[model samples]
Target: MNAPAHDNGRLALMLNELRLPTIGRLWPEFAERSDKEGWQASRLLGALFEHELAERAKRRIERHRNESHLDPSKTLATLEFGLLPMVSKAHVMALASGESWLEKGATILMFGPPGTGKSHLGSAIGHALIDVGYRVLFTRTSELVQKLQAARKSLQLPSALAKLDRFDLIILDDLSYARKDQAETSVLFELIAERYERKSLLITANQPFSGWNDVFPDPGMTVAAIDRLVHHSTIFELNVESYRRRKASDKQSARQRQLPEKNQEGGTTIMS
Candidate 1:
């Protein structure tokens, strides 16, 4: 039964005021059932709160996911972990499930050749973290360096870093793309130093530590950045073959194999 007009209107108003629209809109039906069953006040109140909290959580997850700036297609369901023998599914699932390591500012460093799905893995984990309420930002190494460099020119580098501090984890894709120049490397170094042990980082790179000199201007700076990043981090070396190449090869082979299977039995076989 519908609630009385006055009760419906006033209850809706109260729900709006208290920011519990989910429970407010449906409470009238619940109220009718409660009246029928003689549910106590505490039970009714608890039901309302449970709906409200569930809605709040849903909204929170959406908000975080939108703000994460990650590839929407990259998610746990999209990643074919079986093809990547080097990747440990257990470890990645653990990291994705729990926020302790990310919240405490531990870094995840992923290294691999191009097309090896390093970026995919990084973005997927980032989205998973967002699902669990961790604020994450995905950016390329070059783009972030350019942003930081521009901020430095305007003397707002500190302000920029302050803004970045809001995210729980920063996914820096293509860490190997940073140009080997003082101006570029300096800003990159500053960014690393600022987040050192203060915020979590997820970095994808094509180069190993010994080859990092190509990105940094000097050996000392490279060492410094490496030291801070590796101090509390999980290094994932993705040595498997490129996923793109493998996928393309599979498609080609499928087409090639289908050509001989249908000729004699099929209704039509075109000949020029």
Candidate 2:
């Protein structure tokens, strides 16, 4: 027998009040299906609960992705893994799972020349981790350092750092650009120190450790920062041709191939 109209209205009201929007919208169709198939009450309840949980997980992932500020285009699926021969796809996939290392607050340091896909790989990792229910934040190291510096001047540096702690991982892209002066590097160091062994960091830098003296003002500060990051860390040195340069060269070659050729009489002839 069909539920009375008043009973259905009351159930809808109760579902809305209880904030079960997904179930509320879906229950009528499920109820019809259950009636048609003669499903037991337990099965109907289990189905509803499963759908509710699934929808909740989906919404949570979407919310986290928006807040992550990751480039939507950069993901593991879109990355040209073949070009980065030094980076093992198997290893990256394992890290992307984010089960073991992220929980331990391990760091991921990517060292490479510009346009070599360091930033792309870092962003891809962030996207992958987010899919597994970890919150992430992606920002240029220089931009984040400036914000921290401003927070420091306003006496809200701790608050800023605390806010960042909510993210399971923070990806600092282009770290070499943040080596402006003492104030900026100090704030950056504080961020590194604050998250040490507590939250994960994924940093991409154009310069290797030997060239980091240019990044940190003092040698002692440099050592401390490196020690904190390198401890329990996974390092990826991307020694590959610049992706941008290769792409441009490929485009140029294709255009040259498409250009019309001159015939023996100097007249342009289209090549088939």
- Which segments of candidate 1 are over 4 A away from where they belong? 1-6, 251-272
Q: Candidate 1, residues 34-89: lDDT per residue as tens digits?
A: 99999998999899889989889999889888888899998888888977888888
Per-residue lDDT over 1-272 for candidate 2, one digit per residue giving the tens place of the 0 to 100 score:
99556588899999999999999999999999999999999999999999999999999999999999999999999888878888899999999999789888999999988999998899999999999999999999989988998999999999999999999999999888877564467888899999999999999999998888777778999999999999999999987899768767878998876664425347767557
Our model 2 lands, by Cα RMSD against the true structure, at 4.0
Best by lDDT: 2
TM-score for all predictions? 0.88, 0.89
In terms of TM-score, how similar is model 2 to the real structure?
A: 0.89
Give the Å shift of residue 241 in candidate 1.
Answer: 1.4
Which prediction has the highest TM-score against the true structure? 2
